[model samples]
Target: MTDSVYVHMAEYLANPGIIGLAQSPGDLVITEFMANPAAVLDSDGEYVEFYNNTGSAIDINGFTLRDDGTNSHTISN
Candidate 1:
């Protein structure tokens, strides 16, 4: 599954000229995100994990996580 995702992203990046949309490389990615937990209730179980895929550090202070257009949460360090 990971291989397929990489393949698709590679294809998308390679054909950006045809799509007329250029995408720059990103540093952070959501390695794990769970809205519900098996061992605990939702109130205490929802969590997200991010990985810095770049060499430099990343500050995600102003980043936002949104489930929909109206509902969102800001990430702060």
Candidate 2:
């Protein structure tokens, strides 16, 4: 969950401050990612999975997923 997220240019990541206690939605962590080599599109079987530690809803309306340094995607829904 150490992703560089911004909400209207404001850092929306859970800033657990000094003690390192995690905040609400930040508890949702990336659990797994799938990557496989396919005969056609190499990235056809790629996927990511996340798990929410807290039983609360999270609003990621404008969150962006940027990894790999070259490709990025902003969540719209």
Candidate 3:
């Protein structure tokens, strides 16, 4: 199994990085996500985990899981 994440930030998102949100609330939005391949029988496996890179809390159970773009799992919060 692998863990994937989706984050909701109340501001702008930038690539390569962003700056100038020191005194403003909801001025930056950043989400950290990752996914890895599933394990197979008799084979070495890799899994993915996600970390929150912002000052916020993420509700993981509210997300759904998919394999090959097909519905595989649905998390209930």
lDDT of 2 by residue, 1-77 (tens): 45342223123544323232225555767677654446457776776676767666655555566664446656676
Query: Which runs of model 2 end up more than 4 angstroms from their true locations?
Result: 1-26, 35-44
* Model 1 alpha-carbon miss at residue 23, Å: 9.9
By TM-score, the candidates rank as: 1, 2, 3
Deviation of model 3 at 57, angstroms: 1.2
Q: lDDT of candidate 2 vs native?
A: 0.52
Model 3 spans with C-alpha error above 4 angstroms: 1-46, 69-71
User: Which is the better candidate, 2 or 3, if ranked by lDDT?
Assistant: 2
User: What lDDT score belongs to each candidate, Candidate 1 first?
Assistant: 0.53, 0.52, 0.39
* RMSD (Cα, Å) of model 3: 10.1
Best by TM-score: 1
TM-score per prediction, in order, is: 0.55, 0.55, 0.33
* Cα-lDDT of candidate 1: 0.53
Candidate 1 per-residue lDDT over residues 1-77, each given as its tens digit: 12111112333344554332224455457777765478895548877787777565555554567663355666667
Pitting candidate 1 against candidate 2, the one with the higher TM-score is: 1
Over 28-73, each residue of candidate 3 has an lDDT whose tens digit, in order, gives 2333323443545532453335545446554445334455544344
